[model samples]
Target: MTETLRPPASVRLVRIGEEHAGQRIDNFLLTQLKGVPKSHIYRILRTGQVRLNGGRIDAARRIASGDLVRIPPLQVAARTDEPPSGAVDAFAERLTPRILIDDSELLVINKPAGIAVHGGSGLVLGIIEGVRKLRPEARYLELVHRLDRDTSGCLVIAKKRSALRSLHEQFRENAVKKVYTALVTGAWNQKMRTVDAALDKNVLQGGERMVKASAAGKAAATTFRRLRAFQTATLVAAEPHTGRTHQIRVHAQFMGHPIAGDERYGLSERNRAFRQQGLRRLFLHASRLTFVHPGSGRTLTVEAPLDAELQSFLERCP
Candidate 1:
């Protein structure tokens, strides 16, 4: 049987809470109006059907504690396909053991490969959602940064709005130190320690996003240090100076040493060879992160060792 749900016929004035202070208005509305289409939420926002403190506000405006949000009438369709409670519990259970750091203001985890940081693009759940389920008591939890779904390692989550803002400032100022471990095709030249290139991001006709080195693009740089050498590849530590979409991967490709098992921006022949040797995923891992502890104001570092699959593949490399 099809069922329909509708919001109140009259406008609502909701007072923002401290927990939601730093969140964008659109996101706050999504939480308040569950089951409403994201497009609908943005449409009302653009047309000023939504207002902040009796004034029209844009989607990007951050809400503050005690601010009044005026919501117009909304019609929402009931969702029948919510995942079962058991499934959500199982997902949270699997992630609990992967946590590397937990405190009053921060949570760090060794994010597993194949799980997106947040749900979108046809995925119903991601690391952030799972964490929410894991710690339902948390009033606020937000991703401090993002890692590609195929890359496994240290990921940070902020538990307070202040922490999120501070961490974001640190990232924007390039004060955070991130180190990644990657296996690239061919022997890395000892003296070739850096790749300074500009990358342009583009979406193809089929909707596949790609980044390539271009003369007119965002400036990016990555410092590379060879860690280990094998018969067909070299393991290197890559520290990106500027964070851009797929910066390290594109920089490695620009230097003629694309990461092994990287289907995008990589050599098909080399990928096939690595696959035959049991490399099933991209040979990239965010090995470590160093930043100021947002709550304590102390230097902190978190590390995640390579997973067994990656370790075993390295052992097999001649």
Candidate 2:
């Protein structure tokens, strides 16, 4: 079945609600105008086609409750059924069983590898979309943080705006404690406790994002503890002091031991050898997270155990 979008015929003023008050205007417009191209959304904002409270507004402006947003008419092409109905339902079903915690303000899940946290970069459906489908009545659902698509483990989602803000603040202040489990290509040095390297992220001509340890990059650090060492591989626990994109993977690479099965940064020969031995995905997992509960004001800790594949592979490592 093909998906069709019917753009509104005329300009309209929409009153912002408390649930969406602090959201960026660009994000608000994306939610308001479904099926519209992302570039078009930014274009409209750049040209002042959208407004807040009868005044032109930029995309980064935070909207407030009771603010009136003017959305201009648009023409969008029909979107084909990229993700079939069966696929969407299958994703939702796969995510439902992985849910670890669900409360009035938060939803935590042991996110499975290979599924993105939210739809983007040519993906039509992701974890957030699947969760919305699971709970149709949920008024607000947003990702508090993100995990790489190939990295499985604990993920937190906010069910309310206030909760989202609080969690964001926690992350910004580096108050959230995150722990990851990883298997690297070589035995880790027990004496090396930390990798305090700065990382610079850049996108290549083909749009592939890459991160490297650079002196001019933002400060990043990760503390590592050797868990168990095999002949050629080592399992370790990593605690990141700063949240940078692919910090652990890059730091591991800088230590001459890229993560096993990390296609972008690991040794190709090592990865191929591991693949033959049944390790198919990146050997990185968000094993645990600790933070203050937004609503209860109590310390909360969540842990996701290694999946069967990872655990079995570790058993086979020698």
Worst 10 residues of 2 by lDDT: 1-10
Off by over 4 Å in 1: 1-81
lDDT of model 2, residue 144: 79
How does candidate 1 score on lDDT? 0.86
TM-score of each: 0.80, 0.82
CA lDDT, every prediction?
Answer: 0.86, 0.86
Q: 220-262 in candidate 2: lDDT tens per residue?
A: 9999899898998999999999999899999999999999999
lDDT (tens digit, per residue) of candidate 1 on 87-196: 88998899988999999999999999888886544456789889999999998888877898899999999998899878877887799999999999999978448889
lDDT at 212 for candidate 2?
98
